[model samples]
Target chain A: MAKPTSRADSSTASAATEAVLGRGAALRGRVQGHGNVRVEGKLEGDVAIDGCFAVAQGGEVVADVQAGSLDVDGALEGDVTVSGAVVVRAGARVVGVVRGATVSVEEGASFSGRIEAEFDMPPELGGKAAR
Target chain B: MAATVIAQGITIEGDLTADDEVVVQGTLRGKLSSRDRVSIDAGALVEADVTGASLSIGGQVTGNVTASDRVDLVAGGKLVGDVKAARLTIADGASFKGNVDMDV
Candidate 1:
């Protein structure tokens, strides 16, 4: 598989920022970003970020989240669009439409959705500024 | 002192902003903001805003959550909020709902 785009310059790890959906956190809206994202709480709406998105264990989501890639381990209810890969861990449950180039779901995981995918990360992540 | 642990069966209502470690195994209703580690134990129920340097969840939450360092949603956990964190890990048995921001 091709490498994913870097969210930060190789030299500056602090150049990155992440928004969290903490355990008991909740929101009802849409989100758009130029970076990565991780969901560990609960949400209801849409998400469009330029970087990767992760749904951790114990986390739950019900929205349409779009990002470069997605690594999920929990429960999700909605539609997802991943340009790169979508990894679903064991015991995770997902229900919706999914689009990605690479899709991997571990045993014990459950999913019910649509998927379409194919794309690789760029090489020069630390080279230019994206708007 | 030790961290604040909300043992199972306990519940609170209000926002939380702490400077030390905290563990929730009960229920909360409000906002939670911390400068240290925050943990939500299994069977816990939280309904508040959450913030911390590092966060770990193994329960249920219904609010907004922000972690500066890392956020981990362990198995059997349920979350409902917008997330912001540097590192995020969602393992098996987790459920969530919200928008996420991980700027790089």
Candidate 2:
């Protein structure tokens, strides 16, 4: 068994502003905040964060997510909107409509969703871009 | 380390169920049920019903609490609700206004 005091100290030292949903835990509701959040368990609801959001391996999320950035390596099933980049790593399973400034999907990942990335077109190609 | 930690600056408004240890240092406004230990650290705010095997409160809680093992309200903790546990302790400097049921 780990000491509570030591664990608290270490967690604070590592990610003082980040929130974590550790393994073996599950939440059913809404999570909204301005700090970074990482999930390694199960979450079913709506998530709206002003900072980065990540879903680690073994994690599962079923919700509508809005964040600054998103990193996924587990299972995600929802509509995602991010102001920054969205990276779907290998071994991830995602099914949703993703909208971000940039989207990158790694090999070996299972994705069944629509990706909309907003970017400016090169001048040589077109001076203005249309959706 | 606790299996689940609601770190500072985060707010969760729903139901949380954990099979292992859970530590809350932020805000929770719903229901919390854990099979293992539950810790409410200082500066944390909880406005929900809590159930766990054991619970340690060092923050502010405004709801009913049920513990199978024990419930410890440490110094600096503030609770305004009912408590149901086999063993309970309220340390000095802790503020509490609630009913206690020891099952007897």
Q: Which candidate is the best by lDDT?
A: 2
DockQ for model 1 equals 0.04
Candidate 2 residue-wise lDDT, B1-104, digit = tens: 67888877789999999999999999999999999999999999999999999999999999999999999999999999999999999999999999999998
Show the colliding residue pairs in model 2. Answer: none
Query: Lowest lDDT 10-mer window, candidate 1 chain B?
Result: B1-10
* TM-score to native of every candidate shown: 0.47, 0.90
| Candidates, DockQ | 0.04, 0.75
The residue-by-residue lDDT of candidate 1 on B3-98, one tens digit each, is: 444434334454444556677766667667767888888887888888889889988888878898998989988888888887888897799888
Q: Cα deviation in Å at residue A27, candidate 2?
A: 0.6
Candidate 1 residue A99 C-alpha distance from true site, Å: 0.5
lDDT of 2 by residue, A23-108 (tens): 88999999987677889999999999877789999999999999989999999999999999999999799999999999999999
Write down the TM-score for model 2: 0.90
True contacts kept of each: 0.00, 0.89
Off by over 4 Å in 2: A1-14, A127-131
- The segments of candidate 1 whose C-alpha lies over 4 angstroms from its true place after superposition are A1-16, A119-131, B1-104
